[model samples]
Target: GKEQKQLASELARKGVTKEQAMRVKQLYEQQNNVNASNATGTDVNESRLREEMKENTSDMLEDHPSTQDLARSNQVFGRNIFNTRNLTFEPSVNIATPLYYRLGPGDEVIIDIWAASQNTIRQQISPDGTINIQKIGPVNLNGLTISEANDYLKKTLNKIYNGLNNTNDPTSAIRLTLGSIRPIQINVMGEVVQPGTYSLSSFSTVFHALYRAGGVSDIGSLRNVQLVRNGKNIATIDVYQFIMKGNIQDDIRLQEGDVVIVPAYDILVKVDGKVKRPMRFEMKKDESLSTLISYAGGFDADAYTRSLRVVRQNGQEYEVNTVKDLDYSVYKMRNGDVVTAEAILNRFINKLEIRGAVYRPGIYQLNGKLNTVRELVNEAQGLTGDAFLNRAVLYRQREDLTTEVIPVDIKAIMDGTSQNIILVKNDILYIPSIHDLEDRGDVVIHGEVAKPDSYPYADNMTLEDLIIQAGGLREAAS
Candidate 1:
């Protein structure tokens, strides 16, 4: 009791009122079952209790967090989910067409010969990789490019169809054109949904081959996707660029022996705060901030998009930085970057707090002289399904610190029977939720009645009517 009095005196000296100090002392005494009247008890039980209390009090004091630690814990960059994983390739979106696409068997070619009599022949490369032209017989076109084949065919045809004119000079003209190119067999291996060799059109790209092989698997990394030609890595594919901005720079054309390798997804970045979906998203190398945001389902309606933050994963901690510019496409995202979208805090002097029974319940910006309760309600998407609009209360804090609770009948105002109330700054509009219909306007019957349950109160309801509705009085009724 002496120790409790000392603590109460300390609390009172530190600005706690006598009543609050007494309450705290009484609460402590009740919780610990300590008697203040016999504070200096020397019983063995009292000593043990005092020791336990001392141990618990010491532990609590020791566990109390410092201000600096609290501040650090409350920082926005805390709780980052990004992992530091080295990326292999930076995403690129500049695919150049293969200028020397090889000709193979099954490729069709058109040959035109003009010598004495014009003759045109359409032929396909046989399985032996040779084309049989009229008169010229078989010509090997295996492993030849379009330009090389054209040159080779024209030279051979011109020589065979050469016919001397009166001047004794060779007067043969030959035209060669490539028809349908043969489908190229591409091997799609690695972490794709289906890994196998697929025959795609000669014009098919790496993405097309991936599609033919059922695309990358769920655990596949689009950023580290590799295109290998003849056992050599040709290009890195970053599908995010194509997904976000329709960029196909890395969608290089596939060739025979080309392999589309979808490696396992290993890079991750975290996105939180004011976004439709806040979670850790897998990212490919060279993806921009805009792509990451799109992956997270874009910004929320309440997001302050003007300025967002990114917490870069440093060795043992995170480095937070704010990005004020809205052009996120140009900013390349790293693997361990945490993107955070801030919400607009109602810091302006002209604001209203609209709470409960509304689609959007928060602080709303108010315009002077022009802002009204109806306009604010409309901005909040009107009332919720269970809103009690008839009994809406508006709490206004006066300059002298006194609060005025004004009852509002929103249904009457909407029906044009009541005047529209103009709302001022700092007004708190609370729309109550609908209660159980049976509990509304109810009257409770006390003891001595047959049924002591509450009944719905009606205009001019007599005690006898209530008694009859409550199943009448019991025999012991007073």
Candidate 2:
């Protein structure tokens, strides 16, 4: 009752009048008090029952309604909220056989000289791109191949070991071998997922760097991915080509301080009219008409493949005569282009009329070339039981613009006695009813008549006589 009174007060504050609020409070107080006491007028038992219900509800809530169990039962993985199109291009990576490893800053090398004194030393290149050796001073090793660095180090060390003129000797007094390569830090910016600076191995390619950066995002374009080094675009990678057919020519090895900039997807083309997957497709660079068609899951079976046309953004129309010789090179596509694959047109004769006692008589379409009367009758599920087979008439229009009525023997044709007649376009076949009773002379009394019905024929059946036979017209009838 106190809770009900508080709720009524809230309702009064929310636009209910004071009198109405009091009435609602009193009504709830009556209902709540009605079940508060037993027939003996004692409320102790009711209070005990309420406490037991609360305990039971609390126990039920704690037993099997665990949040972790509920979440585990409903958890799902790999469920994408947005539709993703799988579009892959040929891979075109230009790579050669392993030849030489270049020595740069952070590259380690071990130098061993086997002479009067055994001198073995391990040195890493300094920040200035040089390595300091005993008696050889600082030697620039940046951008020098392993073979070149080894030769330079040998030539310098030979000056201290033997004589500089002894460089022509094939046998060197010192032996050097390349050690570990340093990790490079590159930046992946723009529309890629988790774009940031990533530390990778010096031998890592562009694909490895991209994988570390979480690859491109949903809106990222795969066509014009730019690789920037020293504020210049070193290469534009088309991952579509690599994805379609292992042609990773542009998957260049990443250098230190390299930046991969992925731009937003910009190209979009719409496909409609007799396509299996008719939807707007996001296009990659150098995408042509053929590529777009394939992106739309190819043309449908009824598609007029030869009659493909495209409407460009500027309203310019382009058509391809044949899909056989369709060279995507010649028929390039652009953004906002609308491509349509027309359907094969219906050209065969299709209209015919069948009236009277035939079992499903109506105007039917004879789409086939050799549409005969037997086929048309079969299509209508044959004639009715009361059909006059002997008096069947076939009315055809001649080329000279005259109607020709030909009597057909349907019974003989059905029994294989006579050849069934071939039907033409726009032919009308009528089968009369077998019950050829005399035409009853009657007058139809309808609309504005008191008794709207048919009256039998008389010697002189006038409109007045018909009206009299149908009973007098009411006042509302005219």
Candidate 3:
């Protein structure tokens, strides 16, 4: 009852209709009653009731004004990379420390001094970015590269030990190296799946921080990811460049207290039909239709490259415009634009087909040399001996897309008595065989015959011939 009241209150807050609210109340009551009655019933009954209730609730929620908008903004391209658990962007601790890596707090520094007497010292950088050496005193190494820190350390330790900086003095040598790396805190906010602060390794890049924050949200823009430092946007990282071309030039290493912001998309266009990859893609303002097509993996083999159809939303309504191939580079795409690459028409040009009573009947080219009906017949190795020469039908498609049967006098054309009929595109010529023109019945010799089977009838055949062909009559003949 308490849950029902809360649901009703939420529905009222959302301005849902009174009838809809009452329906939800009825469904809740039905669920409670079902659960109470099914206490002693099988698990299947309870599971079925739960499923039905869930489906009803989902249906009602789908009809809600707020959920309808969410349903429309479902999937976007390049957004599912982080949704999988199999892939991770965690920085490996086993990698060698980069030379350009700067020293910071929480990082361990190792100093090895060897001479007639060797000694090793290991110290972690304090919160104030200083590591204390036993005899050499405290040395600050903040915001300095590894090389710079090594030089500073060598100069500071030289005062305590003699000949520490002399390269020729192998007996008195010093080495400095990093031990354990530090961890940096990064804030990933704005249109991300999980917008919060993430504690990550200092060696982590922009991708690592995004992975820790559960990647960009559905409405987030992957094309313009900003890397903000000290309240200033330092770098703009385009994830599409990395996802498409595997170029991670802009994936800079993170610093302490860095911010990775994934703002909402600026322009989103969908490319559908006859493309290698058909889906919605986020584009930048300066990008053109050609760039969008490249993101969709170019056009499929059967795509009509001559032109494309684009539907753009103008005010409250949508207007369609046909984009030619020449204008693909210049055409600017707008938000909510849908571009379609339709397949070429399923019709062939400069082709003709011939079948029925032909020696080698098949498709033939309708070129200048083979334009007439006589030439097409000759290209098909001429017609068979049983071909009916009186009339042949040519199925031709007209401009209206309707089939028109044109009768060709094959006998007149072959005899050169009539003018040769010129063939057009997609014309199917059919010359009927003589047998197809007439029905030849079969003769059945049953009962008294030795072979009681049907035989094809022939002209000028007598009863004696029929009996002989049937292996003579049986001895018990009627």
Best by TM-score: 3
Instruction: Tell me each candidate's TM-score.
Output: 0.49, 0.46, 0.74
Candidate 1 residues 82-176, lDDT tens each? 12123212223244323376778888877676767488778888999998866768999888877787677666766556552223565765555
Query: For candidate 3, what is the total of clashing residue pairs?
Result: 0
Candidate number with the higher TM-score (2 or 3): 3
Write model 2 residue lDDT over 1-478, tens digit each, in one string. Answer: 5755565555544454566555544554454576565466346655654465445434444543355544432321111111233322212234331237676789787877764536887999998998887776898889887777667876677677664236465343665666677888999999777799988877777777666666677667677789999999989887656655678788887788999998887776677778776766667656677887776678888888865767665656553334342564457666666777889876336688888877798888876643777777777788888888776889998888699999988888766788988888879998888665346667788876678898777666678888787786888874
Lowest summed lDDT over 10 consecutive residues: which window, candidate 2? 75-84
Taking the candidates one at a time, how many backbone clashes does each contain?
4, 18, 0
- Candidate 3, residue 290: the lDDT equals 95
The regions of model 3 sitting more than 4 angstroms off are 1-74, 112-119, 160-164, 167-175, 409-419, 442-478
Question: Every model's Cα RMSD, please?
Answer: 14.8, 21.7, 12.7
What TM-score would you give candidate 3 relative to the actual structure? 0.74
For residue 333, what is the lDDT in candidate 1? 78
